[model samples]
Target: MSILITGATGTIGSLITARLAEAGAEVKALVRQAGKRDFPAGVTEVIADLTDVPSMRAALSSVRTLFLLNAVTPDEVTQALITLNLAREAGIERIVYLSVIHADKFTNVPHFTGKHTVERMIESHGVPATILRPAYFMQNELMVQQTLRDYGVYPMPIGSKGVSMIDARDIADVAVAELLRRDRAPTALDRVTLELVGPQALTGAAVAQAWSLALSREVAYGGDDVAAFEGQMASFGPSWLAYDMRLMMAGIQAFGMQAEDGTVERLQAILGRPLRTYDDFVREAAGQA
Candidate 1:
């Protein structure tokens, strides 16, 4: 039985797909359209959209494991619920869901609330799944690279509370391990939840300091200004999405996206190495800058 991956074109999904395929596992990637992207050799491309029932059914057919990752969209709830219900109908043995950290607690954030709703359904229905709750992606800094280079500022409004920003690559590695374990088991594994996070929590100023060290110059922390951040986001995308992100950022600023104690130790044991640090990410980003 093959492992089917949704959101397969995205950064973390792509990494997981490539690694699974390289490990000689049977893999299938769900794509909205064909020929728009490429996958590693021996990986099957399953043309499907999350909202298209017939297509989703075909994609889930004969699949043993699923990596359920729906992009944050207006209809994220509908898409995820539909795909998940279909997975159950198909009797899929294992599912790995990518959810945000503190999804249940972040009730005001649209995407977080939507994921929490899905999490509730999964728990209520007893789906054999592994829920990976990851914190803010360190790679998100790539979007502000130009700003950092020219203005010497770290522009994200992650505040003084501190966030344990995780690496997408590390998330992918943990996902691959979970998928393999569930898929190779003789019977379906029990449901589980894993909080994915970086090794240490860093505040906005700390992140700026890391960039400063990496670039050998002073970099200022762009203070917590969710309104300004929202306005900036709205200039590039839908206002509603920007507002939704504003709520998420406001929540982050108020309550920091921190991992529980010993989370780092547990993650290290799982990956057989230390978690990736923001300092390393900064150094690499600066080197390329």
Candidate 2:
């Protein structure tokens, strides 16, 4: 059975698919569209949407390991519960699901709450599961790339709260490592939850300084009005996705998004190499630019 990668078009999911494909692992991508996006060589792409349980089940037919990524949909609750049920029915032996750090505690955020729901569903199923609870993605850096380039700065609601902002690519690296050679990983699949994080934790001001140094521009942060941000997002943003980010950001501004333990040792212990740092991430983004 091949590895079934859901949300293969997304950032971390794409990285996981590529890393697995490059390593010559048998992977089948669950996609809703074919020839719509580029993927790695020797990767099989299957057209399946998470909303359709039968299609998802069909895609999971011969899959042993399932890498589940949260998909933003208007009907997120329905889709998430159905997907978990189908995975169980398909007899998938292993599940590596990506969830946020404060998934279990957050309720204002519908998406995170749904993720927590999915985690519970996975637990109810007898399948061996590895839940990777990563903090906020560093890839959000790209959203303000233009702002950074023009104003030479990055900004967020991060106050004194030091968060272990993880590189999504590193999260993907961990996912591929955790799933590809199952027996070689931490071996705590069923009874454990892994928190993936970057090399260091820094405040928003500290992050701005890092960006300033990296891009040679004085990046500044601007935000204290949670209402303002939420309003802006709700009005002009993608319908289903707008609130998820706002609710998560509200938690961040209020100090709910920070990682409990330092993430360096655990990250290093898993990857056998230093996890990617914010500086490295900035450099990679700069290179892409």
Candidate 3:
């Protein structure tokens, strides 16, 4: 069966696309610009925009399964809904949605709320779907690589409260499992939601220590300052993005972002191996640097 993966060039989506293609599935990568990047040998590149429903029609043709991954933008809700409605119209058999962990509880956060809304739409739309709600990505630390190397500090606004950050590759593995399972007997995962998290919950200090061990340097936890965080984010993007991120960080500070009990166990069952730990990710990242 052919599978269409949206956001096919992104961190998690690229991993899923490669794995699916490696498994010999007919993989169609939905890219806004087709010739920009190379894909797996057997993968087909379909030029389409999620916001334009008419443009997606060709991409959804003959697609049995779809990995819906929308960008975290202000128009996330509209974009997802448009694509989902088109997928349903195209008679797609299965959908795997990449949502955020604790999206239901974090309604105030724009991106989280958008995912929750899309999840509901998937359920009500009668599409057999698996929702993979993953925690904050451990790879997110790569964003502050410069600061870590120069200042020896982990400069995120996650605060002292712990979060069960996970590796994007693990999330991709689980997504591939769900997509490949269409040939197997119907399981509990159909129309089910799973929280994907790492082996342990870690605070800012723990993250700093992990980096220190990996880089062989003294790395300290930079305290959470919303204003400073917003300013830093704004330098790279728009003021609204910084504002939204500040609110997300503020929410994380007030209410921790730890995973639920048995989250790791569930992920292990899907992966058939131990979940990747923060230290493991750190060591690998350090090696690449």
Best candidate according to lDDT: 1
lDDT of 2 at 248: 74
Tens digit of per-residue lDDT, candidate 3, span 1-289:
5889999999988999899988988899989996877898999989999887778987887788888999888899998998888888888768888998888887788898889999888888666888888888988888998899999989897877778888888989999998888624353245878888888888888999999999999999889899999999999999988888888888788777777788788789989999999999999999998
On TM-score, the stronger of 1 and 2 is 1
Ranking by lDDT: 1, 3, 2
Q: Model 2: which residue pairs collide?
A: 152-219, 153-219
* lDDT by residue for model 1 (37-124), tens: 7899998999999999999998898899999998999999999999999999999969999999999888999999999999999999
Candidate 3's TM-score reads 0.95
After superposition of all CA atoms, the RMSD between model 3 and the true structure is: 1.7
Give per-candidate clash totals: 0, 2, 0
Judging by lDDT, tell me the better candidate of 1 and 3. Answer: 1
Q: What would the TM-scores of all predictions be?
A: 0.99, 0.91, 0.95
- For candidate 1, the per-residue lDDT at 205 reads 96
The global Cα lDDT (0 to 1) of model 2 is 0.77
RMSD of 1: 0.7
